[model samples]
Target: MSESQNVIEIKDLDVRYGWGRHSVQVLHGVSLNVAAGCTVGVVGESGSGKSTLAKTLVGTLKPTRGTVMIDGVNVSSVRGADRLKLRRKVLQMIPQDPFSSLNPRHTIGQALAEALDPRHADVKKHRSVIAEWLERVKMPAEAMSRYPHEFSGGQRQRVAIARGLIPEPTVVIADEITSALDVSVQAEILSLIAGLRQELNLTMVFISHNLAVVRQVSDEVAVMYQGKVVEHSPTAELFNNPQHPYTQSLLRAVPGTPGFSIDPGITEHISHENRAIA
Candidate 1:
C-alpha cells in the first residue's frame, strides 16, 4: 500500500534486551505496514517476537532501532504529555488477560467510566455511553453494576474489548486476546471482533499463534519466525502457497494436516533455515 493509505508504518524495527556483548536481540529488522481499517494477523510460535512487536506498537517496549509511525506520529519521538495523548487517542491495546487488567475493587461501571473520561467525577454521567458500548459488545447493560470478579473469562474478555474501544482510538492492538479462552469462547470472541471491526472500520494488529483463527480474522497475514517476518501475503494466499520454509512447516504442522505434526523436527527445520538466512 502507498504511504498515504497506510495508517501504521513500521520500518526496519530492531529490539534488544541489553547493550554490547550481553545484548539479546528480540526483533531483527522487522517491517510491516497496516492499511487503514484493516486487520493484519501476525502468526508465530512462542519467541517469534509477536508479543514484542505488539509491545512496540503499544509503546510498552521501545524499539532499539528503526521507526514506528502510527497515524503520522512517530512513536519513539513522542514523550511526556504527547506520549499520554498518543496512548489515549492514537493507540490502545486489548491485553491477553482481562481479569488481571480490570480492577477488582471497582464496579465495571467505574472501570468503563474511567476509560470514557479519566477525570470525570460522575461515573453515572457515562452510563448511557457505557451502556451503548456494552450493548455493542453483546453484554447486558446491567453488567455495569458487577465487579470484574463476578464475570466469567469470556464475559471479562467482552468487557476488556469494550474498554479498549471505548476511547475511540486510531489503532487497537489485540495481543493473544483469545489465548486464555476456551475453544467455544474463542469462536464467539473472534466473531464479535469481526463484527466490531466492520462496524467501526477499525485498524487492528491481531497477534496469534493459531493460523486458522488468523485466517478467519485477518485480510492479510504476516508469518514471523525467529524474530523476523518470513512471509507476508493475503490470508488465502499464505495458507495455500506459503513460500518460506518456516511458514510451510507451520502450515504442515497444523493439526489434522495429512502427514505432519509439531515436534523437535520443526525446530530443526527452523534451525537450518536460520542458518541459511544468516
Candidate 2:
C-alpha cells in the first residue's frame, strides 16, 4: 500500500521483552499497513503477539528494531514528552480489560474528561463534551456521574471506547475489545462500534481471536501465528481462499463454514517453520 494512503505503516517491527537469557522476542520482522478510514482485523490464538503489536502502535511499547509510523509520526523513535504528545494526539489504545484499564477510583465523567484533556478533565468544566461522547457510544449522558463499578461489563466497554475515541486521535488500536462479553452483548457492542467507526471514518487495528468477530468488523484481515503475519488479505478473499495452513485451519474452526471443525490429529502438525505467507 502507498504511504500516502496508509494511516499506519509498520515495517520490519521487532519487539522483545525482558533481558539476556530471559528475553523473548514476540514480533519478528512483522510488517503491515492500514489504509486511512479502514479497520484492519488482526486474529491469532494465544501467544500470537497480537497485544504486543497494539502496544507498539499506541507508543506504550517501543520496537527494539525496525519502525512503526502512525499518522506520519514514527512512534519507535519519538521519546519522552514527544512520545506523550504522539499518544495524546495521534493515537489511542482501547485495552482488552476495561476494568483494569479504567480507574476504579475515578468516576465515569472524570475518566472521559481526562481522556480529552488530562490536565483539564474537570468533569464540571468539560461536562458537555464528555456527555456528548458518552451518548455517542450509546451510553446515557448521565453515565458521566457514575463509577466504573456501577456499569455492566458491556457498558464499561462502551465507556472504554468512548474514552479512547474522545481524543479524536488519528488512529485507534482496539485490542481484543469484546473478548470478555457474552455473545449477545458482544454483538450489541460491535454494532455500536460499527456505527461509530463510519461516523468518525476511523482508522483502527482491531485485534481478536474470534474469526467470526473479525469477519464482522474488518475490511481487511491479518492472521498472526507465533509472532508473525502468516496471511494478510482483504476480508472476503482471506475467508474464501486462505493460503496458509494455519489460516486454512482457522477458517475451518469457524461455525457454519465448510470443514467447520478442525481435525484433532492435525493439531500437532500445524507447521513450525513460521514462514511468511505470500
Candidate 3:
C-alpha cells in the first residue's frame, strides 16, 4: 500500500487500437500500483476501460504508450519467450464468463494441464499438480475429466480458477470473474479467491463494476472514470468517504431491495448517466 512496496506499477499507460486515421484510445494516461500481497480493485461503469486495463496486465493487450511493470520489469515491452515467462510465472488472469472462457472440447484436466505446461518440462508431468490445483479451488477430483459444458456455471468457474492457479503465478488479474454467477455462487468464488490470496500470499488486481463485490475483496480501491482513475483509497476509506463524483454515483446506481432506504445524497454531483467518456 506504500510507494516503496509496489509489486506492479503502471505509469502514464495509454492503450489504443490501430493508428493514424483509425486510432481510438481506450486508456488515457492511466496509472496505479498494487502492493505486494495486496488486492486492488479497479471499479467503473461499462466501457470505462476496466477490461482494457486487465487485458494489458495479463499480456493480451499492448499499450500504445507507457509501461506495465511487474516485479520491476516492463512487461508491455517484452516479446516471445520473455513475455511468456513473465505471464506464466508472475501474472495470470481469471476471465469474466467461465462458461465461455473454458474450451468445450477439452476436459477440465486437459485445460488445467495446459496452464501448468509452462512450468513442466513435459506436459505429462503436470497431472498430479493439476489434481492438486483442482482440490485447492474446491473442485472434486472426479470433475477433472468432465467437459466445461457438463458442469454448472459456478463449477466451471472453479475449474477456470484452478487453471489460473496451476501456474502458481504471483499476480492474478480477475476481470469481473464472478459477475455472471448467482449471488450465492459469487460469494463462494469470492471467498475462494480471498482464501487463496491469503494462503498463497498472492497479489491480485480485481476489476469489476460491482462496488459491493469490490469492497468485499480489495484492500485498496481505484475508482476509474472515462478511462482514467479519479480516486484511489483504502477500501474502507473509499467506501466511507468516497471523494470522486463518479465513484459516488456508482455506489448509488447499485440496486436496493424493498425495505432498503437508499441515500439520495450520493448522486448530487453525478449525472443520471455518466457522459464524460468517449
Candidate 4:
C-alpha cells in the first residue's frame, strides 16, 4: 500500500525488559506498515515478541528505540494528556485475557461505559449505547447488569470486543482474543470481528500464534521469530511461498498441514535450523 493508505507505521522498533546488565531485548529492529481499513496478522510462537509489539502499538509499553506512528501521531513519544487522548480516541486494544482485563467488581455496563470517550456530550447517557454495543456483539442487553464471572469465556470475549469498539477508535489491536476459547467459539468470535470490520471499515492488527486463524481474518501477514520479522507478505503469498526458513518451519508446525506431527525431534530440528538462519 501507498504511504497515504498506511494507518500504522513502525520503523526499527526495539523493546527491552529491565535495564543495565539485567536487560533482555524482546523486539529487534521490528518494522511494519498496515494500510487503512485492512487487517494485518502478526503471527509467531510464544516469546516471539508478538504481544510486545501489540502493547507497543497500543502505547501500553514504550519502545526502547524506534518510532510507532499511529494515524500520523508518534505514540511512543507522546506523554500525559496526549497519550491518553491517543488511547481513548485514536487506538484501542482487546487484550488476550478478557476475564482479567475486566474488573470483577464492575458490572458489564460499568466496564463498557468506562471505555466510552468521556468527551462525548451525552457520556452520562450511555445506557442505550451500551445496550446497542452488547447487541452488536451478539450478546443480550441484560448482560449489562451482570459481572464478568457471570458470563462464559466466549461471552466475556464478546464483551471485551464491545469494550474495545465502544470508543469508535480508528485502530483496533486484538491480541490473541480467541486463543482461550474452543474451536467453535473461535470461529464465532472471528466472524463477529470480520463483520464489525466490514461495518466500521476498521484498520486492525490481529496478534495470534495460530497461523490458520490469522489467515482467516488478515489481508496480509507478518511472520516473526526471536524478536525479528523474518517475513512480511500478503496472506496468500506468505502461505503459498514463504521465503524465510523460520516461516516455513512455522507452517510445517501447523496442525492438519502436510507435515503435521507431535514429534519433538522434528520440532527441535526446525528450531535449530531457524536459529542458525537468524
Per-residue lDDT for 1-278 in model 1, tens only? 78899999999999998789998999999999999998999988888899999988878888999989999999988999999889987899998999999999989889889887877834689899999999999899999999999999999999999999999999999998987776667767877887799999999999988776787789999998889998999899988889999888887785634322233332343344335535
State how far residue 158 of model 2 sits from its true place (Å): 0.6
Off by over 4 Å in 4: 118-124, 254-278
Give me the candidate number with maximum TM-score. Answer: 1
TM-score of 1: 0.91
TM-score of each: 0.91, 0.89, 0.87, 0.89
Separate clash counts for every candidate: 0, 0, 0, 0
User: For candidate 3, what is the total of clashing residue pairs?
Assistant: 0
Reference-based TM-score, model 4: 0.89
- Model 3, 1-278: lDDT tens digits are 47778989999999997879888899999989999999998888778899989888877889988999988888877889988888888888888888777878878877887788845434347667777888898787877778898888888888888888778887888898877776666767777787788889889999877776777789999988889999999999998888988778766663642212122322321222122211
Error of 1 at 188 (Å): 0.5
User: In candidate 4, what are the lDDT values of residues 49-91, reduced to their tens digit?
Assistant: 9989988898878899999999999997888998898998899
Q: Output the lDDT of residue 110, model 1.
A: 90
Residue 261 shift from truth in candidate 2, angstroms: 9.8
Of the candidates numbered 2 and 4, which has the greater TM-score value?
Answer: 2
